[model samples]
Target: MKSGQLNRRVIVQRATSVSDGAGGQVREWPEIGRPWVKASLWSTGRGAGGGQSAVADVMQDNQAFVIRMRPRDIATGDRIVLDGLNYRVRAVVDPNGRRRELQVSIELEVPENA
Candidate 1:
């Protein structure tokens, strides 16, 4: 809850639909706000396939992260970009119920060939 704990910079973005001039709408992620947050690694999981063939084994990394920052108008399905990586907001909570701080839970899944 202390300001000093918020050492990482993160950009909060929301999905917006814009007209593509073709009678259709395109989803765009626009920056809503940037805030200093404290990010902590909650959990991590790695898995591989049972059998490998010609293709390399797929490595899936699911990471759970919790970030704490000042209260803001953020919601689920919003994205938090940090260090060029995008994370999806899973849940948000006001830990103190005073609206002074928010504990946001976010998740990131990376699939790579190993």
Candidate 2:
């Protein structure tokens, strides 16, 4: 595959350390490595509440969308749009666990325009 097409965006996301409601800590990706979904770009804004907020609230030129793909549709070199930014898939994987969810790491920019 051409490396040029592998352009992507990456953001270090934080997963909350959930308590079992008792006395235990657990970290969840919520949806696993952020999935790349296509959506129209929107303006940026600020948020008021705590916890996870919408990308539009934090991104400068934000894009927003609801993902519409089967878990298997994700692959390396695919273009993903998250928070109005373009990202290229760098790595695709499924961390060993009880589920078959995939995790993808994307880069923030592409050296060459595609």
Clashing residue pair totals per candidate (backbone < 3 A): 0, 7
- List the lowest-lDDT window of 10 residues for candidate 1: 50-59
Instruction: Quantify all predictions' global Cα lDDT against the true fold.
Output: 0.75, 0.41
Off by over 4 Å in 2: 1-70, 97-99, 111-114
Regions of candidate 1 where Cα sits further than 4 Å from its true position: 44-61, 109-114
What tens digits encode model 1's per-residue C-alpha lDDT throughout 25-89? 99899999999998877533322122111112221246667788899999988999988888888
Per-residue lDDT for 101 in model 2? Answer: 39
Best by TM-score: 1
**Per-residue lDDT of candidate 2, residues 9-60 (tens digit):** 3332434578887798876433335533322223234442221133223233
Give candidate 2's error at residue 66 in angstroms: 18
